[model samples]
Target chain A: MISFQHVTKIYPRNTIAVDDVCFDVEEKEFVSVVGKSGAGKTTLLKLLLAEEKPTQGEIFFQGKSINEIKPGNLPEFRREIGAVFQDYKLLPSKTTHENVAYALEVIGASDQEIARDVPKVLEIVGLTEKANNFPEELSGGEKQRAAIARALIHRPEVILADEPTGNLDPYHSLGIIRLLLKIQEMGTTLILATHNREIINSLGKRVVTLEDGRVIRDERRGRFIL
Target chain B: MFTSLKRVIRSGWQGFFRDGGLSIATVFILLLTITLATSLFLFHGLSHLLISSVEEKADISLYFKEEALENDIFEFREELARISEVKEVKYISQEKALADFTEKHKDNPVLMASLAEVGRNPFLASLNIIASEPGQYQAITDFLETSDFTALIEKVDYYQRRSVIERIFSLTSTINRSFIFLSIILSLVAILVTFNTIRLAIYNSREEIKIQRLVGAGSWFIRGPFLVQGVLAGILAALICLLTFSLIIWSLSPRVETFFTDLDISQFFVTNLWQIILIQFVTGILLGVISSFLATRRYLKI
Candidate 1:
């Protein structure tokens, strides 16, 4: 479970990235954040990931203020959540399998476990055939799947995906959405942020819409209304 | 922890080898730094030898007046030996000088005839003074100039040797000082160049680093591979430098020996083989590791 209490993020030169945002999601819920460019969707995820601080408010994961977590314990805390990027930030030097295994390796996973879990997760993302290929050798859709595999290999409680399908074709985009649905159905909380109306409307799940740095609407089974 | 360490090392090797262009550039720069370091060490040895040789060739011989007594010359030798700057002073009597001259020119009949025409020992009894250091030679000369036996002396020979001795002293000191200064400047440049290159390589991997952090990798876990890359580059450079220097010294020693009597570079290399390697290895590895550690630090914030 994650909660944001009146979080406000203002960049330098008086640019409000996220303004007075308050939200909460219970365990195992799938929610989409709909917003235009510069509407603070990515900033929201970054704040939760502790990559950036909220300019003015607190973010809580479970019962603890995520902001108050010491830098030394940050990585330990981050292990409870997974994230995917629009660009599918895969390690260029690593093969697809290695990239996925890296997540487990960070947590001191045994070689046997990595060898076991990585392939299974890669299979779910439909990248089993391209496991040995490097990111450079994979296509756009395949690369995103590899990123998804990396995110899924450890099975963290919450998966924060920031425009995961932004780079994919319509066919591949739908495939990624369906993959997220599968992940959500398996009892993992999913927070997806995207600008695509089709994907948001198709989700028919809880939606939080943002306009000019503030959440304008929130509804159960919400439609894309930005 | 053991499994994690193994994974870290494996990924590090993979990262190093997979970035062909950056790895090559990093290795080349590291090689250059190690080579400069090794050369500085060798030059220090050579300078020590040359300076000592120059100090050895320097001495002042005092030619006593032809009429001065043997006892007087012997007493003067005693006084010269008492000076702290003087290592030793030998009294070469006129008889010994004549005998040495004849023995040295025995192969030349003309020189023997000229010496025989004199019908007696024609050489002067002189005191040969050796100093412990080139700088000390000036003090020795000064002592001789103010000596009470100056009236009994024909020429102190201090003025005669002063120009050459001072030149050698200045030249050797210049070499030592310049080599040290050059080493300092060049080492700084080498370190900076290597650091910046590794920084660039890290910058290229910034995205992957973020992804790693997002996937719950600790700072050390993400840092391990880059540090490993640096170690590999360092080790390879040191080995290459060792081989290169060995080959160069072995081949160039014979030629270098022609100019510097009794100084064999290859022989010196062989004598201090382990020492040289240790210096090279420590320098190369430390530079590589420290640079990587620092360069990767900026990106490990997550």
Candidate 2:
């Protein structure tokens, strides 16, 4: 459902974040972008999210050019793709429930739907008891789970998660990976970027490996190999 | 759309209250600006009152000889009144002048005895001329000196009082110009200070704004709450300023009256109540809303 064709991103002062990399993911496919730190995995997801324009090349989602999307249409375009971050970028001012509801809120969902779906998603992520807690009050795992719930609440066509469990413990990490697997099973495209080798090997799904801003490997059911 | 707007307002209200210290600081800065604006308005009025009172004391009086007929003096008064520059011309008869003098000095025995010794209504019949402006007195004096009735005139007091009239004129204009200049500078400074304070406050939330954008929230959706907060703060500041101003004007009115009995400041305040309210509220709300709009625009670029 998403395509990155010869995408390259360069920052100021001659920093090549992602260089001439290309990849594509099928609908409902759970693609893990495996790389060490500074491997351009996050940059690749950011380009897909249109958070940053590619220094060179074009990204397409559902056969539409992401680079051509105008500023006024960006919000509508973004609502179709749910995004989760390593830091669990929940609105600190909002409780867990409000944070999840925010995703639906942006789409102009009915109040009944928000009141209905927010709790359902919060329950799916096992955060029902902590629905009213702010991000500061949540544990790392809970925070990540809350982020996942927000990502899932909108039921977008794809979920792009960047280092979602980077700060979680191994036990919490496994639980997050399991939750992600369950989400993928429920027919949502997933692109997870992480440097964690164990989680990659355990998932044994489609893996696009990056090294020095270049895609070194792309394999169906690939192993975590440097 | 209505639901979204309601949500935006709710979110803003929550943000304002949740950010206790920041909200208070923002309101405090806005209050200072509104207060300055209202004070400037009142000061403009007060200065006008002061200048006009001084102008009242600076008229020129023309003394007529005893031989000048009442018809000639009345006709002369009519001619002076027709001049555009002359604000007023009152013909004070010799007898009335003497009566006024006696009435004024009735409590002083020395002035009473001196007046009685002179005994035959020594005061001259005179025309008191008030020019619309201090500088116009010179022209009116010139008219009197060149008039056909100059033979009947004893003296025109303009030359004697020219320096004081010119001084009053210059002083009023200077006061007016200086006040306008000071008002502009003070207003600019207040606007800059208030803008920066709000910008810095929004800077603290720059990260939150980015995250909201990345999460697919629209620009207005994210900005709406901040604008709402701005409106709330502005309204509160204006209300507080209005109350404070009312109390202050009330307490100071008695003192002001003691010095300038002709000026009833409290009555003036009551008369201009709606105008002052409009100025304060408009200023307060515009400052808050515009500052928030600009500050958020910088961060909403994502």
Query: Per-model C-alpha lDDT, please?
Result: 0.88, 0.92
Local accuracy of candidate 2 as per-residue lDDT tens digits, A123-182: 989999999999999999999999999998989999999999899999999999999999
lDDT of 2 at B157: 86
B1-302 per-residue lDDT for model 1 (tens digits): 78878878888898888888898888898898889888888989987977787688788889999989888888888888898888889888888998899889999999999988988788998998988766887788778779889888998787886888788888988888898889899989988988898788889888878878877888889899888988998998899999999899988999999998868889889988999999988988898889889988888886
Error (Å) of candidate 2 at residue A165 is 0.7
Clashing pairs in 1: none
Clashing pairs in 2: none
User: What's the i-RMS of each model?
Assistant: 1.1, 0.7
Maximum-DockQ candidate: 2
Q: How would you class the docking of model 2?
A: high
